[model samples]
Target: MTLVRDIREDDAQDWRRLWAGYNDFYEASVPTEVTEYTWRRLLDPTSSLIGRIAEIDARVVGFSVSVLHDSSWTSSPICYLEDLFVDPSLRSGGVGRALIQDLVDLGRARGWSRLYWHTQANNQRARRLYDAFVEADDFVRYRLTL
Candidate 1:
């Protein structure tokens, strides 16, 4: 059986391990400072960023980070699933689906107008699952780093 729960301070070891894997999957080099700050933000009750962990057989196997933001087009907030990752060994075992669905349920209960996320174009494995649950849009995303 699998359990999805909010992240706790004691989850550092597990979270760092899974988070490192997640960063590697995206070929991202996340600095330690950023990771520490993110950890603090996730645990801060007033922060809009939240995190959850998925455990199976008492071992943490995956995690997700989401942010709630106000939307100009609607009164309800928008939920953006900023990050999602599962252990490579645990793929296709319903962990990913469970994490996403948990957030979907949360969004529904919180009156969020939308729950969305973005993944690398080549992340076919995750895209497949996301495609199944959410509609695809033709919008293109561009970012400018300062």
Candidate 2:
């Protein structure tokens, strides 16, 4: 069974390994400083961001990051599942599902109006799991990189 728990100060080393795997899967080279900043943000009590890690047999195998913000459509805040990643070697062992399910439970506890996330259209593996949970809406995302 996978244990899903909040990120801790001592989790940096293991979390970095999973973080690197996530970046590798996306073919992006994020700088170490950015990761350090993100780690700090995740631990900041005032920050809206939340992070959770999945471990099996005491080894970290996956992680999820999320945020809650006010929604225009409802008074309750909406949750954005910013990132989800599991070690490729352990992909099919329910780590990802456990991480997401934990986030969903957390979001509901916090009174979030909705919980959502975005991913590359080509990420078929992830899409398959997501598809089993919710129907895709007819919405497209656009962005301008600063």
The prediction achieving the highest lDDT against the true structure is 1
User: On residues 1-146, what C-alpha lDDT tens digit does candidate 1 reach at each position?
Assistant: 77999999999999999999989888899999999999999889899998999999989999999999998899999999999999999999999999999999888987999998998788888889999897679999999999
Let me know the TM-score candidate 2 reaches against the reference structure.
Answer: 0.96
Model 2 agreement with the true structure over 1-146: per-residue lDDT tens digits = 99999999889999989899899989999998999999999888889888899999999889998987887899998889999999899887788889888978887887778989888998888988888668778899999999
What's the TM-score of every candidate structure? 0.97, 0.96
For model 2, the stretches where C-alpha displacement exceeds 4 angstroms are none
Best by TM-score: 1
Residue runs of model 1 more than 4 Å from their true location after superposition: none
lDDT of each: 0.92, 0.89
Report lDDT (Cα) of residue 50, candidate 2.
Answer: 88
How much RMSD separates candidate 2 from the native structure? 0.9
Report the Cα lDDT for residue 31, model 2: 91
